[model samples]
Target: MNRSAEMADLSGTIEVARVVLVIGLVFLHYFAYPNSRVPPFEGFDPNHHQVATFVNSFVLFFFFSAVPLLSTISGWLFFGFSARPWEAIRRRIGKRGWSLFVPLVIWNLGALAIAFALRAVAPTSSLLGPFGIDFAHFGLWDGVDAVLGLTRLPVAFQFWFVRDLFVTVLASPLLWLMLRHAPLLAAAALCVAWLADFTFFGLFIRTDVLFFFYLGALARLRGVEPRVGWNTTKLLLLVYVVLMALRALAPLAFDPSQPDQREMLDLFTRLARPLGVVACWGLCLRLAATAWGEVIGRYGGFAFFLHAAHFPLIIFVKFVLWRLVPAETDAWMIAHYAAS
Candidate 1:
């Protein structure tokens, strides 16, 4: 086939791959591990329930692994066909406008308002005793602490992809230049950066940041679509199965009052995490080749927003439902948890 025909085939294949990645992400978040444990009281206790663990193990893996893979690859394929980086981004931002930032601000404010309200009413469940800020803990710096407290908001963390994506969109032009010149090198650097953020700096460095996402975009942009052959896919699937088994067996290990569970997961997630992401993505891509795949492809643009909005949306809806039912035995909680 001619070069033009080959490029067209490549683009079509990438579109399919992108759809699969997006679907995999949605499944990982809602289906794979929904009620992730969050350590209560803030310590390294192994028995704590952790929200971060669920987000990282299920939601984050899909977001970081799949979305970047899809967006970057799709962007790259389109770029190869003559779309300019700035022009594409301009079009994207123009369509979305300032609507995207609304979620970030709303999530932040919502988290704070809820926390204070909870503290005033529920006290114990709302804030940890020794670790929490109380009347005694209050001082001139109380206000400053309050603002910083927003960073710890669990609901806000759910929409982290929004802040991260904003960074990616902003940096697209520079990322495009780098991808055009050196794609493999860019991917390698990003992998190193991710490892450093996860293992070394821990939560201080957010992998969801645009620079990391941009790296995935660069890989896809540079046309580095490695077709994982059937054998590779099978091997990856086997590894994923083992990891999920481990996950099921690994009971809630970290307490919120101690070491972050994310650190614990990051340490072990090293071996099987990437493998699972690749396998899941590969399977989705294959599935996307059918009529259903075409339907999924149409929703690709909305995936990021949906992923980011799920957490806040969940909380907002739950609060409304709580007002109606006003009981711990409310049936809505069951349905809400089951749905998202």
Candidate 2:
């Protein structure tokens, strides 16, 4: 294919990937944990509620790659098929300011407003009560922090992805240089930091994300387009299933330190992330090739909105669900997942 055709094809793949990734976000924020409640996340026994237990396991195990894959996609798009290095990076940064930063600020303020309102209306509101925030005593500084992610994660925590992406864009020059010259040395250093989940300047910048972004840059540097064809799909499916099974079944037999017969099902979580990225990307590529590709890519216009807004929407959805059901039953949990 010619350069223009290739770029167009990759763009469609990325749009499809963004849509799929946002759907994963729903599975993420809206997850109905086995014993999750005020503090969220607790016991796990597939026996207790087979569907709820394993479905959540699917969310936990498979969806962990959403962010890493997203970072890779973002970095790839930034450098895709560009010959003018400085000009391309500058243009990418400028466009990101509009596409990412603008929406980030708007959504951050919107979330902060909703959280503050919920807190003020009812100090013990489900919104902030469980987090032990005496929203009744929330101050101007707290408001500032919530909006800007100063002291902690921003009120719209998911937007941290956007924030981090923007940061990476600003630093892409350095990352590109590192990836181009001393590729092995740079990747090794990033590997240590990624494994540790290092945060930069207390900004909630995940190094794993940076490392994945680096991988994407490396792909561009090597003129490699990440594609999984029909030939590889079967093997990918086999490995994905095995990982899924390991995630779901391994926890049932082993006991965690909780001592309540609760098994930590995420033993293979970190191990499966890279695979998850590959699988999800493969799905994106395959989906982007079909007749439905253009249809879904059209909704890419609202993908950012859906992603940022869903965090608060899920909160509202859960509150209404709690009011309707007992919140403990397997039926209730399934419904919660469905509504979310």
Candidate 3:
């Protein structure tokens, strides 16, 4: 097929993938491990809550790649067919701003505002502690960091994805030039840095964003579609599941919160994510053929809204539900997940 045709097909596929990934993000946030140490989270006694353990393991693994996948889509769309990095940058930043820094600040500030209210209503609530909303010694620096995400992540924290994404977007012009001059080498270096968990304080909070974003641009530069043969798809899906299963079951042998075990789990995560990203494309195609895909597609434009709004909403909803129900049954968990 021609390059234009490939672009068109990938574009359509990406649209569907975006909607599905947003839904996956919500699922990832609302439905997660129950750590009793964390006020907003619950913990299960492995001896008793076998079912909850299994669910958390499977669900967390399945939905872990949303950010990378979404980042890739953004990169691919930004470059487009002709590769106009400056133009795309202008569009995103030149205006009042759409998806990058502007939204990051706005959404994070909104979250801070809600936290302020929560703090006023329940100064001594333990739930407020987890969110850094205890209002203890709160000062100008704290407020600034919480709103601007200057040194640390904002109160919402999930905007950390956008923070990293914006950093890469701003660097895209140089990235495009490098990719144009040496696509394979550039992509390889970025991939290596990402897999190594390379980090710098000033920029690129997550190296995966840099890798996946450039991966998308690389795909466009080479006219590669966002798919693989069924055989390759099966292989990726297998690898992804195996890695996730390893991650889920590791707690059986090791204390996951300990430094050494946490590093091991982080290693597993880095290895599994790329595999999951491709696996998700295959899953996307499957969903696209069904009614569920159509329903998800209808929510495509709301991806930004959902990503921005889900954090504080989940906190409030989860807190209230926990208070009202006072039970952590499987049915209640499912209901909470559905309600959020």
Instruction: Order the numbered candidates by lDDT, best leading.
Output: 2, 3, 1
In order, candidate lDDTs are 0.50, 0.72, 0.71
What does the lDDT come to for candidate 3?
Answer: 0.71
| Model 2 pairs in collision | none
- For model 3, the superposed segments whose C-alpha errors exceed 4 Å read 1-9, 31-35, 38-45, 83-96, 230-235, 324-327
Candidate 2 vs. true structure, TM-score: 0.87
TM-score of each: 0.57, 0.87, 0.87
Please give the lDDT score for candidate 2. Answer: 0.72
RMSD per model, one decimal: 7.4, 3.4, 3.2
Shift in Å, residue 52, candidate 3: 0.5
Model 2 scores worst on lDDT over the 10 consecutive residues at 34-43
Scored by lDDT, the top model is 2
* Tens-digit lDDT track of model 3 for 212-278: 9899888877878567766777888888887776666666676665788778667777778878988
Off by over 4 Å in 2: 33-43, 129-137, 201-203, 254-267, 325-332
